[model samples]
Target chain A: MDTNTPLAQTDPVISDEEFSRFCEFFYRKTGILFDTQKKYFAERRITDRMHKLGCATFRNYFAAVRFEASGEEMQHLVNQMTVNETYFFREDYQLKALVDGILPDLAARRNNGKPIRIWSVPCSSGEEPYSLAIYILENWADADRHDIEILASDIDSAILAAAAAGVYGERSLQRLSPDLIRRYFTKQRDRSYRISNDIRDSIDFSRGNVVDPQFMRQFRAVDVIFCRNMLIYFDDQSRRETIEAMYDCMSPGGYICLGHSESMSRISSLFRPRKYADSIVYQKPFE
Target chain B: MALVRRAAAQIAEDQPSGDLVDGQERWVADLASADASIRRRAAHDLSQMPDAVPMLCAHLANERSLSVRSIILTGLIVNKSPAVVTGLLPFLGSEDANLRNGAIEALQHMPDEVAPHVVSMLADEDSDVRIFAVNVLAALPHPMVPEWLLQVVLHDPHVNVCAAAQDALVEAGEPDVIPALEALADRFPGVAFIQFAVDAAIRRIRGG
Candidate 1:
């Protein structure tokens, strides 16, 4: 908490006593290997949390945080470690690709016959799926709406409630055209807007993990799965596991999505990056 | 904590503000260098800027390094720029709640602009973001903030958000917050945080 704590004191040249607690604390908690090899700039992050919580020192906060059984302190710790900066429909290109290339292809593949279910795995706060639902409802016909389903899932149960409600302010909806708002949204109040059932019904709000075996059911019949931006958190093994799982559940000629920077070529030969003019989507190999 | 301690030590050792700036400039130059040690040192040095609050706010978006960004958040609430908050407007719909919360936190420091978004966050269903939005309303001035805070304080799923809502109500009260808070607490006794929050808000509202 002392404002006097200099940055150099936080540097690698520090004595063993100064930041050893943080070195042990973070490395143990996240398995993020924060030793001499990496020289992770931990003093500021660790100490800042200590100061904010009024724990006096990193050592004190570390003891309380490391020993805690339930995840509150641990969750707070992870929150401190991560710098979350996201907005709704952040890469319009990704969803735009869905509206143009992915949806049409899926609809045609169905021969306008079967439901085109899409899953936004780890759909925190509903933005991803709601955006997906909105894209489908607005660009395509509600008459064709029976053809698509978006199952939005997240590991966090608490965030799912917010995603289910689908309310937003003028800011969250700033990019949204007013006409689109009028067509696809139900105004909850002067300050709020909720996606109309026309869009919300396409999303089956639920809780599922990208890790456990239980998650396979949610992806059972997905034609196009847009799992963007969540892969950055997974370790190699889990990433491979999830990629395999997503591949397994993909219906014939179904597609898969990942964060813009993620690639499927490295994961498996079964998924060929579906090259389009403006975007790169992935498709399952035709059996 | 080390930053505070080390800054205190450097204050004892350093020459003048201009020299510090020169040193800071050098560090900034090396921020993206291929040398790992230099990058590490630059990150360490950057975390110590006395004017870090304003400087870090300016540099926040440009910095690609997560370590540096985390360090920026680590220091005393810098990046308190109205611009930083405004820039985040596009990201409001981001599926990442952490990003949403960061934007919310950045917005909290700018009181005039803070009210509108804080109001928006109160209505946000994500309990964490809603709770954080309530916290921003706590520090700044918002008349409507209380009603919304009390509403969530009584009902939110995340205990922390409820606590923040209760605190915001205490800081900035509305006429109906008291009765509504009391009723909510009475209805949801299971939420001990809400009950405690109601007690605190009611006590404060009665002008305690």
Candidate 2:
């Protein structure tokens, strides 16, 4: 139980068989691939958690992860394993495309008085969906004319709590212009900043995973989905299933946006690729 | 292997190889001395020797003292050798916070001499390595950086990797990169960040 045990005294190695077990367990739960090349990374992250819990080997830790009574340890493990680095106006051009290109087109096609609903899946710490709200309020002249709803969701409950709290450190504000910072965020006494209530209240935040079909089915008529940079973690099957789910939830003719590196052609043929002046996006085919 | 032999031969021809060996032995022993002060001081002094990078990195595995590991890590940071980056890879997820941070910091700041290694490390299994490689790419002016970053933005599995690549592309991407960026936009239809990163990169390249 001593924290000061010498490196030689502690066993830091993970056997190939042990590593495979971890990979299978991870994929079964998350649908993300953990290949052999990631053996070094996988071993080390597991070792870190193992060392923390005083578990001497990968097998002991695996058993704890699998059989932990409350599942809190499992949640913590997922939290530690997943990376969530995001900021405001991240990939601002995509927002520009949505505002300048996609919005008007969707508006033009609108019938009845239905609200324009946008979902930001895995909306880490609220920066993304809030940025969307800020972008519309600042640039879209038709903002007030339509009923707008922005729903932000993520699988990590810890980050979802943070998104709900809405406080941010300086690192998260690096991409924001001084004007936007001054206008939208109030400086806190601890040097962190809190997003304005106007932007904060504009979003409906929840904890959900895209991999679950049932969880995804809870939403209907999503007009535009901003699920940027999340699919890269998914393996081929996971990616296809996720894309299919997004496709099903979207209203006919609704739009979906993915990470710049994510290619829908490789994942699914359901969404039609559309080119705008500044960006390319996918649209659900009208029935 | 050939490069290390060449470097070693060069070092041997320039100095008394026996004296160099003795000095290295002394430092290695000092790194493990019972006196905390001696261990700390030796690590700090040894880290300043670029030639000591390989040895320091090797010592990192068995070294138990967080303070000593941290000092050795700092020494590795100054080592411009591609091998040092390789040596630091295993510590990316160290249980000790300081060790992990030090390893990442060292790899992050490696000089242009190791730029080629950084490019290859972009595909490293560890996301931290890829993330650090992109940060290094941002500071490098190598001609291949932009395109390499574009490819990563388009293909890396981890969002952090893609994010870093997009940021680097925004900083250094050129007009030649526009077509590829546009193609990527089409590939990932709904991804606003990718499209935005491409747009921003193209705008900067065109002086917009």
Q: In TM-score terms, which candidate is top? A: 2
Model 1 chain B: ten consecutive residues of lowest lDDT: B1-10
Name the regions of candidate 2 deviating beyond 4 angstroms: A1-84, B1-208
Question: What would you estimate as the lDDT of candidate 2?
Answer: 0.69
DockQ, structure candidate 2: 0.01
Steric clash count of candidate 1: 24
Residue-wise C-alpha lDDT for candidate 2, range A1-287, written one tens digit per residue: 33234334465776665566567666654545667786665565677778789887665576566544334566666555666578988878888888788888888988787778888998988899888888887887787777787888899999899998899999999988889899999999999999988778767887778877457756667889999878766643356557756765677789988766465665555578987656678998774
Query: What TM-score does prediction 2 earn?
Result: 0.44
lDDT of 2 at A186: 98
lDDT per residue as tens, model 1, A1-287: 44346665433233344454355545543544456643444555665666567785444464456434233565665555554444456677888778777776776656555566677877887777777766665565432545555677788988888888878776777778888888777787577888776566546776778766445533465688878766545533355457656764677688887766566654334477886547788887664
Q: Give the lDDT of residue A189 in candidate 1.
A: 59
The two-chain DockQ for each candidate, comma-separated, is 0.01, 0.01
State every prediction's TM-score relative to the real structure: 0.43, 0.44
Cα-based lDDT at residue A134, candidate 2: 83
Interface RMSD for each predicted structure: 27.7, 33.0
Q: Write the per-residue lDDT of candidate 2 for residues B1-208, one digit (tens) a residue.
A: 0000011122125433342233556777887888654575566567767777777887777776654665565456434466787677666646665566556555544545455565567778888767766765654434456667888877787766777777666543235667766766676777788778767666655655
